[model samples]
Target: MPFVDIRLAGNATREQKAAIVADVTRSLVERLGKPPAAVQVVISEVSTENYGAGGQLVADRAPVPKMGEDANAAVTSR
Candidate 1:
C-alpha cells in the first residue's frame, strides 16, 4: 500500500481535490505497482492563520486585497 499525505495552507474546491486524489492514486498505481484500492491519499487544508513561514503567518504575509485592487497585479509586478 502507498500512503500519500498532502497539506495545503489554503482551500481547494471539491472538484480540485477529487482531481488531485485521482492523479495521486494513478501515480501510485503506475509507479509503485500498487493497486488503486490499496493507495491512500489524505488531503489536509490548514488555515493560513495557523500556517507560518519566514517567521510570519501565511495570512499575514499574504494579506487579502482591498476592494478594487487587482490581486494578480502584485504577483506580476514581483
Candidate 2:
C-alpha cells in the first residue's frame, strides 16, 4: 500500500485536480508497481498567502509587470 499527500496553494479547477489525481495514480502504479486500487493519494490545498518562500510570504512576491513575458523569456532561454 502506498499513501501520497500533496500540499499546494488552493484554488484549482475541477478538471485540474482530476488530472493531478489521475497522473499521480498512474505514476504510483507504473513506477512503484502498486495497483491502482492499492495506492492512496490525498491533496490538501492551502491559501497562497499562508505559504512563504525566500523569507517572504507568497502574497509578498512582487507581481510581474507584464503577464507571460517573463515566463516566455525563461522558457526560451532554457
Candidate 3:
C-alpha cells in the first residue's frame, strides 16, 4: 500500500481535486506497481489566514482593495 499526502495553501474545485487524485493514483500504480485500490491519497486545503510565510500570513500578503477601488487594479499594481 502507498500513502500520498497533499497540502494546498488555498482551495481547489471539486473537479481539480478529483483529477489530482486520479493522476496520483495512476502514477503510483505505474511507478511503484501498486494496485489502484491500494494507493491512498489525502488532500488538505489550508486557509490563507491560517498559512503564513516570510513572517506574514498569506492573506495579509495580498493587498485588499479599498472602497470603490477596482479589485483587479490592486493585484496588477503590486
Candidate 4:
C-alpha cells in the first residue's frame, strides 16, 4: 500500500483536493504499480500563521494558495 500525506498552508477547496488525490493515486499506480484501491491520500491544512519560511511567516511573505499553484511545495515526501 502507498500512503501520501499532504500538507498545505491554507484550506483547499473540495475540487482542488480531489484533483490532488487523483493525481497522486495515478502517479503511484503508474510508478510503483500500486492498485488504485490500495492507495491512500491524506491532506492537512495549517493556518498560514503557523507556517513560516526564510524567517518569515508565510502569510506575510506570500499570497494565499490558488489553483494551479504549488500549494504543497513545502511538503515532505519519501
Candidate 5:
C-alpha cells in the first residue's frame, strides 16, 4: 500500500478535491504498482495565514490571474 498525504492551504472545490484523489491513486498505481484500492490519500486543509511563505503569512487575499497567465507570472509578477 502507498500512502499519500497532501497538505493544501485554503479552500478548494469538490471537483478539485475529487480530481486530486483520482490523480494520486493513479500515480501510486503507476509508480508503485499499487492497486487503486490499496492507495491511501489524505488531504489536510489549513489557512494560508497559518502557512507562511517568504517569511510572511498569506492573508485573506486571492488575486485571480488571467487564463493565459503562467504560474511564474501569477506569483512573481504580482
Candidate 6:
C-alpha cells in the first residue's frame, strides 16, 4: 500500500482535492505499480496560528503578492 500525506495551510475546494487525489493516485499506480484501491492519500489542513517558520507564526508572516499584479508596478505603487 502507498500512503501519501498532504499538508496545507488553508482549505482547498472539493474540486482541488479531487484533482490532488487523482494525480497522487495516478503517480503511485504508475511509478510504484500499486493498485489505486491500495493507495492512501490524506490531506491535513493546519491553522496559520499553529504553523510557524523562521521563528514566526504563519499568521505573522509576510504578506503574499497579489494575483494579476506586476511586481515592479506593485512595488512602485506601494
Question: Who wins the lDDT comparison?
Answer: 3
lDDT of each: 0.88, 0.80, 0.94, 0.86, 0.82, 0.87
TM-scores across all candidates? 0.80, 0.74, 0.78, 0.76, 0.74, 0.79
| Model 4, runs deviating above 4 Å | 64-78
Which stretches of candidate 3 lie above 4 Å from their native place?
A: 63-74
Give the alpha carbon lDDT tens digit for every residue of 1-78 in model 2.
999898876577878888899999999999989989998888888887998888988776655344647755644554
Best by TM-score: 1
Q: Which has the higher lDDT value, candidate number 1 or candidate number 2?
A: 1
Instruction: Return the lDDT, model 3, position 66.
Output: 76
Off by over 4 Å in 6: 66-78
lDDT of 1 by residue, 1-78 (tens): 788999988899999999999999999899989999999999999999998999998987745565898998756665
lDDT of 4: 0.86
Off by over 4 Å in 2: 63-78
Range of the 10 consecutive residues with the lowest summed lDDT in candidate 2? 59-68
Please give the lDDT score at residue 58 for candidate 2: 79
Residue 62 accuracy (lDDT) in model 2: 56
On lDDT, the stronger of 2 and 4 is 4
lDDT of 3 by residue, 1-78 (tens): 899999988789999999999999999999999999999999999999999999999988877787999999999998
